[model samples]
Target: MDDGGMPWATARAVGDRGEDLVCTYLEGLGWAVLDRNWRCPDGELDVVARDGEQLVFCEVKTRRSTRFGEPVEAVGRDKAHRLRRLAWAWLEAHGQRGAAFRIDVVGLLSPPDGPPRLTHLQAVA
Candidate 1:
């Protein structure tokens, strides 16, 4: 919602909605969502979830269209590196010591007038 007075209402709305969708879906898959839109010095992680034995840190990318590329392809090397660092911060802050963790990417392709397509990529780091 904070766009620094430069309103990107549609984008923000879509992003928020997509994140909610991801959370719901992940919960159904038995993952406990710990945080949404977590911001650290390294970067922001879209979702921090726990899937049983592993702490799953997720990066979510949603797009109205795949004209440019698939949503999953958006997380490049720099972003991946930042996510790794953020995961470290998350682990340390939660007093969650020495659990196996992995990076996951959830891509939501929400084309207008259709259901959103979600693809989960595991261990994307």
Candidate 2:
């Protein structure tokens, strides 16, 4: 994590930084972020938020660079499917039903010496 703008070492740090940035961005857009790193038997969801009347399950992928590809490209069909399942699990655990939900992806590129980039994809599933 970056404390006082100091970067940390490790992939987890990058992810945490990306999530923090995304949360701020979403909040700026009037979305109320609810759960972060929500986990179930299925897997972990990076973020969950309410965009007005809709529930958004967001998966965040972050990288130092795009040498391989954009971070959002890492999420394939399998991952999307799992996110859907996880969304259901979250709803079931919370005893909520008939709620409108959507899957979203937030791709981040945070270089060591420059401003970070963020891409928000809606309805990924």
Candidate 3:
């Protein structure tokens, strides 16, 4: 069976590619990436970086098409809450408690035959 449309492995690969693209895009903006695929009991953080003096936890949503909706629309309030909790866990794990941080969402629409489109939203929650 397929996940949504693509197989599970294919979907995961696409998501990974999207995260890679987001990481490069952030680096291009001069952000130093601290981690990728950081996971805890609560959940996983797609990307973590330092933007100037602030820490950023990025959630990546990738879609092969927008037939259902925009990729960013995938992040709902529940997901945002989970991300916030995961951010705290990450900070604690890295001995960065009480650090200034924000949540960001990177949405990628990767068409099968065209270049991927990226959208970055900062301070989402």
Candidate 4:
């Protein structure tokens, strides 16, 4: 398979890097990251953090090139719904069911030889 013109391993590495960048960025903003790559039967939540009284569930999308579309464009209605469900599952599992929570999307465009560009969309769902 073409794998979108990048090997699976390379693609995974790009995504991991994006998540790492987002985590550092969030921490720089004084957000405490509670969990990362949190996975359950439903799916995975890339970065889960606490900002003041709100819990943020962030989805990270990264690409080496925006040949198809912007990274944030990947999260459509279905993906948003999945993130919501995953967030709820995370809260229940951690005994924080009643906590104020919101979904966020972090999009990263990492070119072959340049500083990556990041876009954060808060309260997406």
Candidate 5:
């Protein structure tokens, strides 16, 4: 893991870059990338994608290692609530209120080839 930026700053950078890799991964799996960093009062979602008729709200967590637990597990109840609200805002603003949607998590382990993973949990929060 790089240490150029402050702890949080570096981590955010890793996650931001990692989100791009995750988006590419998803796109390869037939998911179409949509809005990225869609922010509202309920925090910010890293990426949004479309799989057929379902909209996917993605949360990206990047870490040097999994010493504590899986990166996606970091998304707790509070964050989930905010993401849900943000999703709602996204829906209303995009005039997609009636469309189907779901939530997903992208776990990115830094250092490029260090076992980056994706755990997609549908319909969260």
Candidate 6:
């Protein structure tokens, strides 16, 4: 949990837990997770998976509550554009041999009092 500071350790832990859950859910849906927390000079991608013929670059946002806004609301157009660029860089760096590629976002809302809710938005970018 290298969250840059101890104050954010809990947030980091929650995010990590959410990512694990999302990965497991994706696997159950028959998607093979090719990478987790893949990084480059630009930024980091939460997850990359092979869904039959398409390569999916996923951005995951986890939240403990909706006090500010929903998890999906966190990713805006600018972020989506950045994610697309990152995806291209990933494909290029990995040899650009995939069938096709798309950007997706997974929003997780894990409340302390109840079950976590997951929202998978495919082809967001």
* CA lDDT of each prediction against the hidden true structure: 0.87, 0.88, 0.92, 0.90, 0.77, 0.89
For residues 1-125, could you state the per-residue lDDT of candidate 3 as single tens digits?
Answer: 12376878898899988998999999999999999999888879999999999999999999988887889988999999989999999999999999999999999999899999999999998
If scored against the real structure, what TM-score would every candidate get?
0.89, 0.91, 0.96, 0.95, 0.82, 0.92
What does each candidate score in C-alpha RMSD? 3.3, 4.3, 1.6, 1.7, 3.1, 2.8
Q: For candidate 5, give the lDDT.
A: 0.77
lDDT of 2 at 22: 97
Ranked by lDDT, the better of candidates 3 and 4 is 3
Each prediction's total of clashing residue pairs, residues at least 3 apart in sequence or on different chains, is 0, 0, 0, 0, 0, 0
Error of 6 at 8 (Å): 1.1
The sequence of per-residue lDDT tens digits that candidate 2 reaches over residues 1-125 is 23234455676777888999999999999999999999887789899999999999999988887776888988999999999999999988878766899999999988899999888899999
In the range 16-103, model 4's lDDT, one tens digit per residue, is: 8889999999999999999999999988999999999899999999887888788998899999999999999999999988889999
Worst window of 10 by summed lDDT in candidate 2: 1-10
Worst 10 residues of 1 by lDDT: 1-10
Clashing pairs in 1: none
- lDDT string for model 6 (1-125, tens) is 22234357788889999999999999999999999998999999999999998999999998888876888888899999999999998998899855489999999998889999999999999
TM-score of 2: 0.91
Residue 61 in candidate 2, Cα distance off native in Å: 0.5
Residue-level error in angstroms, candidate 1, position 19: 0.6
Provide the lDDT at 73 for model 4: 88
Q: What stretches of model 6 exceed 4 Å from their correct place? A: 1-6, 97-99
Residue 82 CA displacement from its true place in model 1, Å:
1.0
Best-fitting candidate, scored by lDDT? 3
| Model 2 spans with C-alpha error above 4 angstroms | 1-9
